[model samples]
Target: MATPTQVPGWIAVDWGTSNLRVWALDDRANILAETQSPLGMNAIAGDEKLSFEGVLISLIDAWLPSDARGVPVVICGMAGARQGWLEAPYCDVPARPSDLAQGAVQPNVRDPRILVSILPGLCQRDDADVMRGEETQLVGFMDAHPGFAGWVCLPGTHSKWARVSNGEISGFRTYMSGEVFALLSQNSILRHSVKEGWDDGAFADAVRAAKVQPASFLHSLFTVRARALVARDGAAVAPGGAVLSGTVIGAEIADVLGLLQPGEEIALIGAGKLASLYQAALGVHGHKATPMDGTAITLAGLTQAYHTLKTASERI
Candidate 1:
């Protein structure tokens, strides 16, 4: 539990589809108290009885002090989607990363102690594609690496590759690579065949193979199933999983990685196994990636939005 004196400024939240994380932070963005909940956008959409603010308040209301008249709250992620707490709208691509708060909106709330500011996501109208939470992360990454120009990859359920140039998101692509991998591994026939963890040698081999035969993607995926069936021992299942992961990831890499012009480095923005996997996979293509912590970048992004909006509001 955080003492009342610890919360110096506003609250930060990353409210996604499946979960929401709230952080009580000082002006320095030093977290005072952090809390999480299963009340995500999906829960709000599925449960007709729950309002978005109702869900949000249920989780973090206790952290608010009675003395604060209206503490500022900055939020990111799916909470800004059309189906979220309140629609923050989307800023079209080829937009500056700092301009995310330009499309910000506030929720009609019952809580008198909180002033909520929801940051908008990014959209590609032609492709009919949208990203809800990652834009904040993008801003955070740019904040950390000022003047960084490169191909930045946010590896996740729906991985995103953004071309950041001159402090702007020049353009980007979203791949269903992670989401597809989950479906294939958990719900499909491969479920029984492969488990978590991997064989590094097998993973590297699979990455190389997939990178070569990008067209024979389905055939490559099947090799995992085949290997699972023929394996003499249980040891091969992990490698089978690795191969499956590599194949899918490689296809995504093949799809967009060539845009990496000469001397343009790769910024792999994420943490844990997913990011590590991306780093290793990029290595196979003779590219070195600067790995970053996704959580830190996400927090930095929300903080940036807060300051931007705060400064703007003060001007008015």
Candidate 2:
């Protein structure tokens, strides 16, 4: 059996639907140890109530020292969903992202070695939009860019466009553009049509086409299919992935353009491929986008929340 790494003063967790990660942090906020599990909410051992605590206990049981008393664990993500460990209700927008700590919840568990606090998600009532883990990222981003005010685009499976003003999120919208691309490329016929490796020219042209003729966006998608099937050695085979991504993202960007101010720049918070793709796409509009690392933002946000909780606890 593998021995568990030594525990630290506190734990930071980002538990989502598919997985959960925990970082043991010293009092000074430096990471001492980190681990994760595939036993997320979706793959728990039992019902919502039983599974979360059970899986959580299983994951961190070895980390707790025998004499430890209520080791603080600050967590955020879908683990606090209605059906997860405990529902840390949604906090309405136009509120400081750092204030998420105020909405944290403590799940009732028999274990004395752990005290878990789950941060609340954010909601925009008017838009019928809600976000869980992303709010923490926003807080981290805001922490990095104090007094930042503008459109913040977080591209992923479900891309988010949030308006951050004075450290608070005024409003936001979620797009299924990434999911659309995935479905088209992986599940739909386009998967067979488009190969990897980007063609910048093709991507740029598709972006322009979709942005200008948003209504014909579906027609452009169909073109990829037709080109691939009709011509074996053709335009569609090489640049299918890029074109599909460009077309969907372009339409999304064009649609969301109204949310942006004239010549206003965007804060693109993401990492790796998604970040580069968004930067390239946003560049097409002549709009400047500043890139922020997703992992760094998560750490910053969690640290902020951990401190806020620490402060509150100290006050009491």
Root-mean-square deviation per candidate: 2.6, 2.8
Which residue pairs clash in candidate 1?
none
Off-target runs (Cα >4 Å) in candidate 1 are: 195-197, 227-238
Q: lDDT, candidate 1, residue 180?
A: 95
Query: What is the Cα root-mean-square deviation between model 2 and the actual structure?
Result: 2.8
Taking the tens digit of each residue's C-alpha lDDT, what string does model 2 give over 1-316? 1333566788888887888887777778777767788877777634545577677767677777878889998888998888777899999988786569899999887888888899999998996998999889888888888867788898988889889887788888999998888899889878876766779877877888887897898788998777666776644454787788888888888888756776555889887887887888889987778678887688789888988898899999
- The 10-residue segment of model 1 with minimum total lDDT is 1-10
TM-score of each: 0.91, 0.90
lDDT to native, each model: 0.84, 0.82
Best by lDDT: 1
